[model samples]
Target: MRPVRLSVVTAAAAVTALAAVTGCAEKGDAKGGHGAIAVTAKDDSCEVSAEEFPAGHVQLDIENKGSKVTEVYILFPDDRIVTERENIGPGTRASLTAEVKAGDYAIVCKPGMTGDGIRRQVKATGGTVAKRSPEMDEAVAEYRTYVQQQADETLPKVKVFTDAVRAGDIEAAKKAYADSRIGWERTEPVAESFGDIDPKVDLREDGVADLEPGQEWSGWHRLEKALWQDGKLGPEATAFADTLDKDLADWVKRVGTAEITPTSMANGAKELLDEVATGKVTGEEERYSHTDLVDFKANVEGAQKSYELLKPVAVKNDAALVAELDKQFAALNALLDKYRADKSTYVFTSYDKVAEPQRKELSDGVNALAEPLSKLAATVVK
Candidate 1:
């Protein structure tokens, strides 16, 4: 919807939105693949050796034969990228796991890492995944379904919020803002699945680069300033609202097709906490309206949900890790919960209101949770 605007003022936990949106995959190729599928990236094209693959893990051994830097994506149904690696300098060979399922999918390569790349459909034979255990397969499937549900929940409500803003009914927009955010916050990682949409929709001011003479920032925060700081919604505000509406509606529809693996989920959780440490803990997120607490709470809730859904699998892999995460999550949540202003909001006048001692406690707890959570991806592979 929109953010509350009582007076001239302003607000990752929201970076959970940023990090989730901007994060991509690359490590050692241990994430997926039963055998390497040779890929070649050239100045004009990306060529994968195989047109069809058995459902399961497959290595994409890519050589950037092209003159320009290139990146590769394993696109699932609806063009959702399951995994990608960027900046493959010419003549460099890179590898990543394509943890795929039985479905129709595509491989896309961006020669200069901009715009939609050339696409080629590849069929994935169903019924078996040689590189994935049955349990791991099910876990990924279940997480994908969960992300889809959150997207479904987001679509219609966000429409209402945007409508309120377009109508210039500021009070109505304010009322609808928080609820509209919940679905998005819950599926921040899923939002990241869309290649170009996230940064455009939820970009915070901190991400703004030194604009030359022409660049302009836009997104929810831009609109937040209009309503909260500027204290009025000008005619252009309607256009900003329109963009947010269109992007959120469009992305939610495609999100279900995204591949969500345990490795990604594990990495996503750690990244969310990192956002908390770097942005939320420091009060860098909510610059105008002071709603950083709102995003902070959402990030924790989203992280907790990720941990919960994967708890059984995690416990199976390492009970000790799961136990430690449980304790750390509880500690952090307990600290944050005390700041709850009311049943619905948090009390911090600003993030700076938090004493250094308390801030350190929060930071320490997030750090504690992150260590165990970061290990989750490899734990799943083992």
Candidate 2:
């Protein structure tokens, strides 16, 4: 999970900026080809073209005019992510199409891809979004079922891992760790959409900088450090295990109500690849255990599952893109298989054991897949 840093923009400053932006804003439409919200992301500012738009399938045409790589998001008032497009390199242009319900939302651009991001308040006016075919509706239902199933499957495994940590069985916890994470990894974007859950369950030490004051750090990586880095399952580690269990249980119970859409499914699939690229490929996620490959495979599987579910509509929309996606998915999976210790198990060579050159190969594979995957949302929404 990417950390949420404190925004540099203070409340008074943000209010001033919003007032100035509101004066020049116009109402935009999503159906008449005027739904594109033009965003210019810079080092210190995020400028969006409009302050209001018709609800439905809205498109964000983003240009990173900044010195650093950036990310853009549409967030609810409470900061729940409606949809987001991340990892846009400097001087590049990217587009994101998202389904928005009529409500107040914020258009955000995170230059350097951190923090609460520079924010501009926007509203989605009451209107019908793009119509979906029956098949598309069915796909969303099936994907929802799949996400819930993953959560259901994950709880028992997490119990085993947390139980081991509580019992001070370091070896058993180490063995249970990777297996427990697979389900969560597979549906991470969905979990993250809830805004409150992922941080409690998956936040790493690097994310401590992003924590709000009075929010204590306790989760999987905290327990992971006790097992591998500190070489003991102390009292704090046991407490962290309990905290992780409680947070994840909340996630499993709440996941079914998460909003799932065809565009979201497509966008989420791309986000999974981003997770692999940023965390798994860099060997930063499972730093102590070096079981990054297990998470890597699960992320890929999740992306592929989303693509497969949307393939019918996507293929009907853009056959060439579908063909390319299929090819890249197969190729990347084949490459990952080379590192597998056994076909029957999720085990693979420890990430620390992976040479730099092999890591680059994996990174390249991710980028290759990511480029096309980025277009999936627009494809399915079309």
Highest-scoring model, lDDT: 2
Worst 10 residues of 1 by lDDT: 4-13
lDDT, model 2, position 222: 80
| lDDT tens digits by residue: candidate 2, 27-98 | 333222355778888999988888898876666767887899888877656565656767777877776666
10 residues in a row with least lDDT, candidate 2: 15-24
- Give the number of the best model, judged by TM-score: 2
Residue 18, model 1, lDDT = 9
Candidate 2 clashing pairs?
Answer: 56-129
Q: State, as a TM-score between 0 and 1, how close model 2 is to the true structure.
A: 0.90
Model 2's number of clashes is 1
Tell me how many clashing residue pairs each candidate has: 15, 1
